[model samples]
Target: MPSRTSRPTRRTALLCAAGLLALPRLQAAPAKKPLPPPPDVWPRPALVPGGVARLSLGPSATRPQAHSGELPLLVVGDAIEWTALVGIALAAPPGEAAITVAAPGEAARRVPYRIVAKKYQEQRLTVSPRTVDLSSEDQARYEREREHLAGVMATFSPAVPAQLHMQVPVPGRRSSSFGLRRIFNGQARNPHSGMDIAAATGTPVRAPLDGRVVDVGDYFFNGGTVWLDHGAGLLSMYCHLSAMDVKPGDQLRAGDAFCKVGATGRVTGPHLHWSVMLNRAMVDPALFIDA
Candidate 1:
């Protein structure tokens, strides 16, 4: 009973109403895209006594995942950087730790890793003619110096603002004896705590990153030692210096000269003993340095 024009008009109105109703769903379909896949998880060996676990993150843009026992895993990501922290779950138990990291867009890459743990040991050293034997007065001086060193280490900050900037403090031949077991005069000693760079006497030492000079002094063991506090609980140390050019509280930039190499500590010849600490844990400086 409807006219042809009226029928066409009614059909057009119906089609327009249906289109209006479907528009919201079409817009929402894009919003319902599936999230990215979770990262891969790996289990680590049990932690050593008085030691914490160390994790090396792969160079990937994807976020990382970490779970602590019954607690939910925390995954944090930023534009191109990602990091995760997993607290020690066991008080003194022997169990493995699992860490998961997301792959970067399905691409394969070789990731390097190094882990260091603290252990207790007794060390002995031979008293060479060059070794400074402390008198009672000198002994007091050494104790005071060590206490100051501990204080400086306590105030260190660990959060690195930029990629870990590092350099060999002195230009010299690296000793293969680094981290070696030593038996001096038929007595065992602790493994070398730092890398030994053999350089000529009075060779200038430089800072590897921006930091604040926290302690500088001569001791019976370390000789002329300098400790730098890089913010975020990170620290760098220069030991056995012939001279300390920087004073405490002074700020330093990368490549800044801080000392001159010398055989001041328990050493055979002139060298710079450079060490790095992260969250009170000593790690291999090679991990942060380019070969």
Candidate 2:
């Protein structure tokens, strides 16, 4: 019953659509996805105890996958040659080793590697009997702390770090070096797992690189400890702190104050125990230092 004008003929409808199109339009363009941060220039890693090995996967048209037994490799590169950074454990015996490399649609290849023996100096220390001979409660507490730390060190993210050259946390003399076979209280203990830097108590400790605080806790050995996750299975630990300035889930940039160095834990004097972890294994921090 409507009029012909209300019903609209094809010509009229076309005219109306033309007018609608002439009016101002409100539409948004599709948002662009953010690109990942640029990868850092690869550092040369040594393949010895407490060292990092930079193993090449050869030139390939695509990225390759590599692993050493249960440990995953951090591979970096593109359509060109790719390399892997392998963290050698201090306890690893020097001998021939191989890493399994696999490319898409290709069989995995176990490339042989050699680990040369490195002599580490020994240090004798006289510490408290309670530290050397742990009580039942102390042993239980250490085990619990150890479990918690293992979880922190096991963090693996696909994000590649923006930088590898690290800044010195707190300026101090490198006192107790890494991998020192220490005879403590006449009993042999595990080789030094981290570097001991002699710094004054209450001295501010900064983050060596960009990272997120994954853990902050107190322990029998590493008192007032803090763990930073630097993406791609790279972790850094700051132990024996006098005070912690950051907490879990906090973001930190390179040289940002994180805590204060202290002699807390099982140390004789004030120092910072700096440990660099790659693929859950503690490796040498010296490898990151720029020459």
- Over 29-117, each residue of candidate 2 has an lDDT whose tens digit, in order, gives 97999999875554556778888888878888877888889777788877778888888888889998888999999999987888989
Which pairs clash in the backbone of model 2? none
Instruction: Supply every candidate's count of residue pairs whose N, Cα or C atoms clash at under 3 angstroms.
Output: 9, 0
Q: Model 1 over residues 1-291: C-alpha lDDT tens digits?
A: 877799889999999999898785544444666888864322122244222344555445545443333332223346465444332321223444455444655643332222334343334446673345457876897788768767776673434435454766778787633344555666665556567788988999988888899888887778889998876556778888999998889999888988899989777778888876644555456645665
What overall lDDT, based on C-alpha atoms, would model 1 receive against the true structure?
0.62
Model 1 residue runs over 4 Å out of place are 1-81, 84-142, 176-178
Each model's lDDT comes to 0.62, 0.87
Error of 1 at 284 (Å): 1.2
lDDT, candidate 2, residue 106?
93
Q: Where does candidate 2 have its weakest 10-residue lDDT segment?
A: 38-47
User: Against the true structure, what is each candidate's TM-score?
Assistant: 0.59, 0.83
